[model samples]
Every structure is written in C-alpha cells, then in structure tokens.
Target: MIGSPEHFHQLEKSLARKLGIAAFQSGLQVLRNDRGWRENEISIDYIWMVTIDHSYSGEGGIFAIKYKESKFREKVNPGELVQGIFTNKDEISQIYTETGTTDLRGIFDFNLFEGSQGITLDGVSYTIRISGQNIDTFISLSNPNTDSWKKWEAEIWALGNRMALASGNKEMINLFQ
Candidate 1:
C-alpha cells in the first residue's frame, strides 16, 4: 500500500498504540524504542527500523527489527520486486553485476554459466561466517580471471568486524584484527 503524508501520522499513532497495546495485552515488557520512520512520514513506502523489548523466555528481553513492505500481495506474482528478509541494515546487496559475481568469490564458491551475461550464481556456495565472532567467508568461483572479489573481500571483512563490535561481541573485533 502507498503511504501518503496525511495518513502517516495516524498510521504511526495507530501502530505505536497497537504495539504498546499488544505488548501490554500479551504481557511483554517495553525495552528499547526506536523508529526509522518519523510519525509524520509513515505514508511513504520505505523500510522501517524498530527495536522492542522481547524475550525467547517467557520473561522478556530486548531486540531489534527491520521491516519492509511485503512484495507479496493478494496474488503472489514473481516480478522485479526486491526480495529479502526484514532486517536492519543500509541495504542488501543485489547480485546483478558481473562485479558482484566476482566479489562473491571472496566468500563463496560459484559455478560459471555458459552465457555472456556472466551469470555466476550457477551452483555456487558463499562462505560468510562468524569465526571467533568475526565474519569470515570461504569462496570459490568458476571464473578466476576477475579481480573484484579479492579487492572487496578485505573491506567486507573489516565491516563484519565492526558489526561484531556493535553487537558487543569482543571476539569478532579481535578475530578480524
């Protein structure tokens, strides 16, 4: 559904109230509260970052959530819509370019296709893991001539280390270093 300015505020209020109501009704506690979209801008269709108090235990705890509009509608049609999980991040990397294929090599094993588009997703495996709390990946590709993968792998690994820091996982920081 399209989000318009006039409807955003009401929507936000309704959502917050509902969330609050739901938490109370469900006997959940309120922990951290952050909203990606301001109450005034909820009309625009964009991703949202929300953190709340939750717990795997029946007690309670805190966690984060990132949600995007569902591409699935009344009828499920597979089109050019962005397909991904609700997550908190800058953006998900799309594998549309040969360059991306090359980069995936740093953390994946790719099977090259017999086509000109350089489609490398064919029978490939990506290796992204948290080793000692750091994100390390194993990658292999059918085409070994491209240089993009090696070039970006280190940077990505570094970013992964930073993410570990944000998560308060000290091991990740040391592992990448």
Candidate 2:
C-alpha cells in the first residue's frame, strides 16, 4: 500500500487500534525515488508505475518508476522515461529531465504483482517506506523476530521522524516530540 504521508500515519493509527498492536507507532521510513540514475539514461531494465486506485489519469497522485535489469531483454529501449512525481502532464513535459519525445499520452494501469491470501493477525508487522517529498509510500507487512530488531527498529524510527520533520509534516513532527 502506497499513499501520502498523512495517509500513511492515518492508516497506521487505524490498524494499531483495530489490531491492538503498536507495530507501526514508529514513523514511516524514507526512501529516495530517483535511484541515482543519470538523466535520460535507461540504466535499469524494469520500470514500474504505481497508483493507489484504478484511475489512470489524474493530478496529485503518486507514481513510481523503479529500475531492475531483465534477464531476457537486451535490446535498446526507446522513448523518454520520467523519474519523478508530477502534478500534471504539463509539469511532466516542462520539468522532465530525460530527453525524448515530449508527447503526452493516456496513462494506463498495469499490475506488477497480484495474489490473494487469507487474513491473519498473528505476528503481523506494518512497515512504511516513503519516497520523494512524501509523494509516495510503500507499506510492507511481515513478521520479524530477530535479535537485532530492537536496535534497528529504534534507528529506523529516528530516521523516519527526521525525514518527516524535513518534509514539513506537522503531524509527524508533533508525534516526534
């Protein structure tokens, strides 16, 4: 699940109350959206576009483009690939770092992964990863039981709070104190 920073915290609080657990009391983790790839270069093989809902065309929605090398495809891929969130198609055309055709096309929804599972409350954990000025968040659920969990958990919390403060998230800043 990916959403705005506010939505991330709100969902955390809601889940905590419903599950009777504090798994996500810590602030969400921050991740860099642009994976340090040079502009206009397809350094990675895979590009993923993330959306919260089925709506393909909209402003102020989160989209992610990730890089992963493909084993089968080795040919040069063409066209420009944008690497950040944009408020509108105009913004994408104006501020796009990559160079190529500047044509705006209809956005389409695609599934990177799909599955179904039964619900279980046992050993559940919620972890949020925010990227790009709180424009996107990736929430992960897992059951972790490791000796170093305590140490890393504290570190992650501190880092998350710092990121939230830097992003000017007033709610997260208040929670930090």
Candidate number of the best lDDT: 2
Best by TM-score: 2
* Candidate 2 Cα misplacement greater than 4 A, ranges: 1-39, 42-124, 128-146, 174-177
- Listing every candidate in turn, what is its Cα RMSD in Å to the true structure after a full C-alpha superposition? 18.5, 17.7
Against the hidden true structure, what lDDT does model 2 obtain?
0.32
With candidate 2 superimposed using the best TM-score fit, by how many Å does residue 129's alpha carbon deviate from the native? Answer: 8.0
TM-score of each: 0.24, 0.25
Ten-residue region with minimum lDDT total, candidate 1: 92-101
Backbone clashes in model 1, listed as residue pairs = 3-43, 54-61, 107-127, 108-126, 108-139, 108-140, 109-140, 133-172
lDDT, candidate 1, 1-177, per-residue tens: 112223333333343343332221111223333654222111111112111111211111111112222332252222111111111112211111010111221333323332244554322122221111123222222322245553433444454444445545343334333
Question: Cα deviation in Å at residue 56, candidate 2?
Answer: 32
